[model samples]
Target: MGVWGFLKTQFVVHLLIGFVFVISGLIINFLQLCTLPLWGANKQLYRRINCRLSYSLWSQLVMLLEWWSGTQCTLFTDQETVDHFGKEHVIIILNHNFEIDFLCGWTMCERFGVLGSSKVLAKKELLMVPLIGWTWYFLEIVFCKRKWEEDRDTVIQGLQNLRDYPEYMWFLLYCEGTRFTETKHKISMEVADKKGLARLKYHLLPRTRGFTTAVQCLRGTVSAVYDVTLNFRENKNPSLLGILYGKKYEADMCVRRFPLEEIPLDEKEAADWLHKLYQEKDALQERYFQEGTFPGPQILPPPPAMDSPKLPILGHPPPLTSNLVCNWYLRQRLPPLLILSFLGFMWTASFAVRRLIGVTEIERGSSYGNSEVKKRD
Candidate 1:
């Protein structure tokens, strides 16, 4: 292997790069937390400052992925719509199959100068995820429980909060509450069958409540819906580790902007709107399978600001099961396990406290009864 390629293959190098990015991100996020008190005194100024700080932190991670990992992200949006991407507020509806899709969306947001202020209706579980979730909280990312009964009001309020955000932002909604899996795909198809709509081979059934609430809340604030259809060229299971390990893959993202006027205003109509949107996206995917492309004018977004010239092109190495295991252990299990443990401890303590209080109350009652009997004697 060439010297450049040899260096890329070194596990320690990737580890150090990842560690540095994560640590720096934590520090930046901490600084952002320090600005919370300022919001009460000067909301807009605090928001503007927080925006730049957020971009700095997120851009570092994006650079690590895009520049260090040598992952190239190309945007195929039209110039007219692309130019206005960061200039105004818009609702972004993205497919939620790939883990890195959100990262890719963030990269696009940065290129368009809106990464700091971008928002999404993400799974409530993500709110418990470290760094990413903590940052999302400050960035005003709307979280949903995926249960309409619990999520309805809070989600609407979250969307309403975006009405006067200081900077331009792209509010993303997956519509499909979870990642696409075979089981989910089968169930979604069943739902589609029941609805009498053609089944989609590539996606899961989208929960429409969140999408409808988003449209209703963002009605006047958002100008258009950027229906993004993303497909990987090689149809392999894409993971963050795979992308980090110099896995060369191509992605075709088709962005179609539909005016707000085209979407219906009522809740049921809004739900129908998302169903139709997915149907069209499914058709787009079918075209991709048949003809290998989305039939629309392609606009390549400018190379990301952090793209470096001295990048090494390293082909896929033997699967680093060790690194993969470590990442899986840390990223997937550790955080939630820690949170669950904390909650468990809290619950136990709460129960114990209640028991103690009950005992104390019984003793106090016994003492009072004895004193009353002595007084009667």
Candidate 2:
């Protein structure tokens, strides 16, 4: 085979890359933990610095989905709505259909300069997913158990903690509470029918408790609720592994940001508001199916390379003027660098192992050949 063809089939090479990703992620999380001291000294600045620090590491993995994996993201949002998006804090409600929807959300966050600072109201089950989950802990990604009976109070407390997040953030909420499989969709429609709601063809029953709870808790602190619907072109089901392997696909994100005042402050009213919002979202999805896009003017963020920091650098280190700045800088750069360094080392070791050990190619014997002949060969 030619060199380019061989490169495409290099499974071990990809595994080596994944090792680098896992290692770098852990280092970022560790560095975030080390920022605890900075939090004590200057809470706001510490929170802000950590946001950037966490993004640098996480966005690398996100870039793997687009740059390395060749996935294309097409966001069709209103021009007026997106032009002022970076200036506000909003509750982002997304359709939980695709497995890599979170990654896609992260991609949007990366584009908007908020990937590291982005937050999610994720299920508790996700917190066990190794590097990604552990990193999310420091990012302050909220975890929900799905059982409102158990998660109500805990979810409220988690939202309350974000009242002081120092940077503009996009908090993602999957109102459906789970991915949409055909079986799950059927069950959700049944539930919706039981609740006296119309059946939705492309969705599962949304659990209103979590949405209401989040709205009620994050009311004053958040400015708006961004109702986001994500769908892939041609109904392609994309996975995280597929995205990492350079699989090309298109994703459409439709966003509608509404003022917080629209959501009711009362708990029951909040629940009703969520139901109504879902109904509207369902209608929007149907319209998208008919028209092939959301009803909005197109607005896209500038490419990532355009966002360069404006700070000047001196020839030598400054005399320790402020402990907070020192810690903030330390918290931002140290751990991710170390972890990424370590992962690179491990990946090199694994590549060496693959080279030195040498992979043995096995040839399949024909069914018509005699068993004894095959064994002799």
TM-score of each candidate structure, all chains considered together: 0.77, 0.78
Candidate 1: which stretches are off by over 4 Å?
304-377
- Scanning candidate 2 in windows of ten residues, the lowest lDDT window is 310-319
Off by over 4 Å in 2: 1-9, 305-377
lDDT of 2 by residue, 264-320 (tens): 788788887777778788887888788877777655556652342111221001112
Model 1's lDDT to the true fold?
Answer: 0.68
Instruction: Enumerate residue pairs that collide in model 2.
Output: 69-246
Candidate 1 lDDT for residue 354:
36
Q: Cα miss at 212, model 2 (Å)?
A: 1.4
Collision count for each candidate, in order: 0, 1
Q: State residue 7's C-alpha deviation in candidate 1, in Å.
A: 2.5
